[model samples]
Target: MSDRSGIFAGEDPFAIAQGWLSEAEKIEINDPNAIALASVDADGLPNVRMVLLKEIEAQSAPSGGAFVFYTNYGSAKGVEIEQAGKAAFVMHWKSLRRQIRVRGLTSREEGPQADAYYTSRSLKSRLGAWASDQSQPLASRTALMAEVAKVTATHGPNPKRPPFWGGIRITPLEIEFWADGAFRLHDRFRWRRPDPNSAWEILRLNP
Candidate 1:
């Protein structure tokens, strides 16, 4: 048996993830929720960028355990996600020396939840989403500003969520948690399950 005790002792991986995130929130300097989101292009080249994870959803069987984030549907990441139907991300907390990695299938989350999130954003950000043709080349910053101004006037206050902008939910098949340890050895645990409703099998890996 492995000496997986203390913070790693948990039947629910999601609970452990939540606890780690809570600790990270207290110690991180900024953007505690920022994750390195990874997606593969049509050519199989990997692309990664920092994106804020909006939510860790926990629901009943066949409909649970997803990481949520929003972006323009036409963006490079979005196109990759739609084409591949899968993605992965890593969240690292330097202060805590801990990291969480996830790989999963992707689906669009463009219902009331998307609408509510859109409404919660700052007016400028909401307007910016409407103004930006993300992943497309722009001639100049001035042109972008002009587009923003035009959209601001056209959409006005109480603007609706754009059809091209919404949320993507990732339902993970695997998640790994890692923490720093002394003597150049680290603590690592992986939780894997075939589907959300299936029982998770935990494995302790050498570090």
Candidate 2:
């Protein structure tokens, strides 16, 4: 007999994830798409930060399925991901008392999809992306505003996505869904595979 039911009913982990996220967006106070992205540097030190998840591609996607987020290709996380070829992230919703964790191989998403997402941002955000030298030291806030102004002037009203800025997609080999339970217990289900192309082997973890 299986315990998985209700919210954990789906066979496709990606679809289940999308369902959870859609529910979270209605209750989460802010940034429902926020994920704590984790990566490692060349020295093997761990790095983690909050990033807004841009998309959750379905299993039918060209790359099978992925979690997508964008950043400056020259940024610290970006550089580390390129060096390590892997990353992990967890998206938790306090309101729903649930979380989804993923570990996976990464690749750049620098195509037309990136362009369309860049175009969807507000003008100021788009310009800020062009202006900011992410992960680099800036002298001061004033200097940053000045740079923003410079880019605003140079790039005009409709600037293109910077060559150094785009998306990164993580195709997970492991995905875990967890929800709180009573009396300090928790429910956890993990779907893992040897590779992205392999069938997931599901397991229930003690929590």
Candidate 3:
């Protein structure tokens, strides 16, 4: 473990990640939970976008230490994730001068959990999810809003979660934490495990 101490001290990487996020929340101007989600397309080209980290699932039975986020299943990111079944993301906090990176396998979260989250959204947002064909070319904003209105009238107040819209859970195989240090040097720690239930091997890397 290389005698990791101070902010990097922790047996559980998930807990450490949550702690970093909590601290970032206090100082970040916006979207402290934002992550740059990365995936590969059919052509093997990389794609990335800023997405909110909805939940950090820590130490669970089926999978341990996963991050959760919601999106349209047919969206660009969703298509890439579904095709690859794996992804990586980085959460950087400028104010805290820290960044956390993760590489993981992914699976859809389209069960009751997805339903609950969908229902919790505002009525317009819920309808908009159905109306917007994310990542598709739109003729105009006015056309999109018209479609939104149509969906609102059709689905009414209580719209069920769309089959094509839900959450994705990423179970990380590798996680790296970086913190700023003096003289352009930095502190870096990597935690890796073969599978979700496997023991983590921590390493300190030169920065």
Candidate 4:
């Protein structure tokens, strides 16, 4: 990592990721924390969708750092992650012409942290989480809205975070950083380790 400098200079990949995202937030028009999450179904079919990245835990975290995002446990992405025990994602910033990619093991974060995050959301979002049986068929929009109304009635002003909805933390085994370069010769670096407990092996890859 002798050549690492500027945006890429950091002892922890999670810290570097946070710096890039912070920069993205200032220039991106919307959803600066959005990431294209990838997972596989029970049949091994691939699924990808955009999800907002919620937290990039620091290296000092008890789990040694991770990327966190929330979703319904019954959702397609959630079920896929549970079945396969792995996932990957990419976050790109068109304004900065840079992107970061990660692949890792997955686990649920449905505890006090999940409840705290759920509480921070708008009331409507909290109720919507209770109503939506994500990745499942719904007869019509009206039916869905009615269900939302019913849940709102039952839960009142302060509904508990649904057990079915919570966070997912990805403890990455590999992370790659790429930046656009002249004549399509992009600058690329990948940091990898066999597991979270091991030291990273950095490689500068040709692009």
Which candidate achieves the best lDDT against the true structure? 2
Task: Score candidate 4 by lDDT.
Answer: 0.95
In model 3, which regions exceed 4 Å deviation?
Answer: none
Stretches of model 2 off by over 4 angstroms after superposition:
none
- The count of residue-pair clashes in candidate 3 stands at 0
Q: What TM-score does candidate 1 reach? A: 0.95
Candidate 2 vs 3: which has more lDDT: 2
**Worst lDDT 10-window in candidate 4:** 1-10
lDDT of model 1 at position 134: 97
Per-residue lDDT of candidate 1, residues 58-114 (tens digit): 644345778899999999999999999999999999999899999989999999999
Can you list the residue pairs that collide in candidate 1? none
Q: What would the TM-scores of all predictions be?
A: 0.95, 0.98, 0.96, 0.99
Candidate 4 residue pairs in backbone clash: none
Query: What lDDT is reached at residue 165 by model 2?
Result: 96
What would the C-alpha RMSD of candidate 3 be, to one decimal place?
1.2
User: In angstroms, what RMSD does candidate 2 have relative to the true structure?
Assistant: 0.8
- Please provide, for model 3 over 120-198, each residue's C-alpha lDDT reduced to its tens digit, 9 standing for 90 to 100: 9998889999999999999999999999999888988999999999999999999999999999699999999998778
The global C-alpha lDDT for each of the candidates, from Candidate 1 onward, is 0.91, 0.96, 0.93, 0.95
lDDT of 2 by residue, 51-135 (tens): 9999999999998999999999999999999999999999999999999999999999999999999999999999999999999
Per model, state how many residue pairs clash.
0, 0, 0, 0
Q: State the number of backbone clashes in model 1.
A: 0
